[model samples]
Target: MADIGGVNSFRSFARSWRRAASFAEVIPRRPSFVLAPEGEAVDDSSDWDMDDGRSHIDGSSEHSTAHSRQHLLRGPSLQSQGSEAIAAEFSDGASDALLGGSPSTRSSIFDVPPHLAAADVIGSHSIRYGTINSVRYRSRPSVNHDSPWGVHDEQIDPEAAAMTFGEDNPILVKEVKQGDKVVLTVEGQSTLPQSVFNSINAIIGVGLLSLPLAFKMSGWIIGLFILTLTAAVTAHTGKLLGKCMDYDPSIVTYSDLAYVAFGTRARIIVSALFTLELIAACVALVILFSDSLSSLLAGFATATSWKCICAALVLVLNMIPLRWLSYTSILGIFSTFCIVCIVIIDGLVKKDAPGSLWEPARTHLFPSNWMSVPLAYGLMASPWGAHSIFPSIYRDMRHPHKWERAVNTTFSFSYALDTCLAVVGVLMFGDGIKDAITSNILRMSDYPESLTVVMCIFITIIPLTKIPLNARPLITTADVVCGVHREHAHGADAAAQPSALVHGVRALIRVVVVLVLLGISILFPAFDSVCAFLGAALITLISIILPISFYLKLYHKEITTRERVLSWFLLVIFSILGLVGTIWTFLPKQLVAA
Candidate 1:
């Protein structure tokens, strides 16, 4: 009985051992398995055999079997189709291939998640994940790949990818078409508007009668003076502009002119001068607008309120960037040109008009002769003769060689217009030019309607665009002077040292100069006095004096002795004449108060 019990126990132990070994062989030691679930496996033998149209075993197989039987030859192990055992066998083969000899030969194919295998195949050319494949093919990452999934891959076509993505992007594909190319087509552009064309024709048809409508009442002498001043100032500014262009080869402004003329130290001086000028301009505008509005609108308007509004508008305009302000200046120029053209046409065509548009009547066109000179001079200097802005204009011209042509054209045009208007005013109004000329054309017209008011507003607003251009130098100067005390210093290591402080101090000095000017304007608030004083003082200094000084300084070596003497003589004459004229005009008896 004991022997039989021992035999049964040994048999059971052997059976248990055999079962454990089978399990170990069938199940891999890995933590995860990639084979299909136990019940999901399907035999692929019938499918493969049917596709071949051949028997699984054949006569060749019989012959191979006989040879194998004779030699007991061993062949590669074949796994059962779709079986877990087959999957394990394939996995082992792949692992062996990856890590066969060199470690570098190893691959991640076997380690890749089965679920992502399809994605890998489709996106293999992408940079984000296909760098390995690209390296295998070309030994470098492809740069042309633009697939989001393969951002690092270069093999893919970026243009193709962009087109695919861009198809859905509206902002990327917007296009503008040329409207009309034919010069004489119905849709073609006409240089002037219909209203302007009609006005021009009407004025020309009426002869001298249109002079009243044009309000050109100042007289030929005043007109000639304005023309001369405009031409001289423009010529001087253009020359300076040319020099500035040689230095920077880029668009510059009045501030830039200061920098070029005086070095970085000039920034503050220019800025202070500009700021003061703008403040004065703004105040003047407010006062002018308020006075006009109070008279026109009666109870609805007050000088104080209009002044506030003008101040606010100036501040808002100044806050705008320099580029925008430049655009505004261009606009102002265009508007002024148009208005001047209209006025000239009216004056040239008018018949039986008031003897000189300046003569006292229902309404006067030109301001008093005393005021007209300074006002016209200031207007010309403000925009057309802005010497400080010359450098920038010079820099932007495509053909710097043609700069003289542009300058000549601009000044010539300005002179013709200013002279015509002044002559017409004086011819029409005689001694009454002072009473006729007002802040706007409408103010000089009998009917003073909405159109006139609108035109006046537009024309006046245009010049104010230059205020910021004038103010920048002051700010820069302030920075230079006061910024040195700060913890950190700018431009200290360069050849030029911190001139910003110096500039700032200069700006402060300019501020004082501007304040003095304002005080003078306020004290002698008469329009005629302000115009004459400013024209004689500011225009003469900026136009004649400065130009001569700069030219002498810049070309001293090249200038002949006679030229030098001439320059000095001209400078002294201009200074004396300017001083005398300014003083005479500002005298209480001669002044025409605003």
Candidate 2:
């Protein structure tokens, strides 16, 4: 009886052991490689295959395998140790073939995530996760050979590339380098509607006020044709500029386009031209301010005194951060739109007033003075020179793909406003129209007092607001030239308080710039001449010539024959207009009148 009881106990014990073993096999365990302590024996016959899920034939003797395992365990550093361990596990008879590198070289496998570590690890038993062949580990820097900016095989800048591809949503990426480190920054994007508003605001400025005089000089027939042609060509070039950016993500400014198409010399030349254009615009603003206020404050002060007042105000107001200025910039658009409405309403209501269409007028179907036609063309072209800012607007957009739509909408709205003002001014004032349409309205009697007050307020406010805005680029360029900008540009130093000396220097430079602009305004207060010259010379190059030239140079191979023809034709026409206008600028008004 005792022997039988002992046998039953042994049987029960055996059954319990079997059940425990089965349960242990069923339980899921985190997958990991088992490593032996230093100098321990490693199994040469693979217990579990690390590759091919089959028994690994250790064609390398057991001694060699053990020696390699020991070497991997004693790797120089933690990162390197991890690399060697991976290479050892993946190694076959030809270790280099399996490791994807030489035995002495470290593997990039350590740089990959665990899941991605399964890539090319076919049927491996050590790692049971499903394998993916799609995303392979990249051991080399990515080179973009197809950049439209003519930068070929250029290794993408890591900081800039991170900004470009690291995010899910599109962003305006910038990189600031300090010492040896790089800092990346991203700015929030503007929506389509916001972009459209900004684009329109850029287009509609003091230029709109001069269009009436522009029409008077060009005549109704020639004026309308030139206006239409200029708008269409400039808008098209703006679109081309956006596409150029699309082809090369690195380009962030108009000058960058020039650099890619040509070289550093081109970049410097383009930047200098753009700088001159901005300075000219600042001069125009001063003239516009003085003219508007001088007309309003008629016997109280001369235009020179008003110009001095404007300079003082600009120097003070520019001290306000550009961010705050941008917020108030929307008022400029509203002011301009209001001025247009007042002009249309006043012109229609006072139809029988002096110089109205009902009166005998010197309205010309063609330019009475053929020499003035170039001047007229320049005036008409002035308002369309918003191309410099298009790249900035494009960069700020949330949906950059919708850029063409925004361009079309902005140009269409601007054109309509321009056309409305031009037609009404010609009909109401005929040859009596002053350079500023508002000046014409202000001089006439029976004009609604409320409308005149509104027009005066709007026109005067515009130049005051625009002066600092237009001068912003020059101020920044000054900062760079003075060497103060670099001290602040360092990313690590961004939060550090700027020195008072730097502040004082910047203030002094700004004062000098504003004072110089004041002198120019006082020296050459011919508002129409300045506007016409800018339209004829700078605007033609920036808006018409540069964009088309850059586009042709960048996309010479890809662009169709039709596009090529149209681009060259525009180049020819605008080149003539620019040259003629330049000649008109230098010619004496007395001589031209004769």
Q: Top model by TM-score, which number? A: 2
Tens-place lDDT per residue, model 2, 331-389, is 76788899888887876676575646455356788887877888888888889977876
- TM-score per prediction, in order, is 0.48, 0.68
- Model 2 clashing-pair count: 0
Candidate 1, 92-202: lDDT as tens digits: 534433223332232222222111122222112111111112112222333323221222322323223223222110001001111210000001011112112211211
lDDT of each: 0.37, 0.61
**Which residue runs of candidate 2 sit more than 4 Å off their true CA positions?**
1-171, 174-188, 355-360, 486-500
Model 1: how far residue 399 lies from native, Å: 2.9
Query: How far is 81's C-alpha from truth in model 2 (Å)?
Result: 32
Error of 1 at 367 (Å): 15
Clashes of each: 57, 0
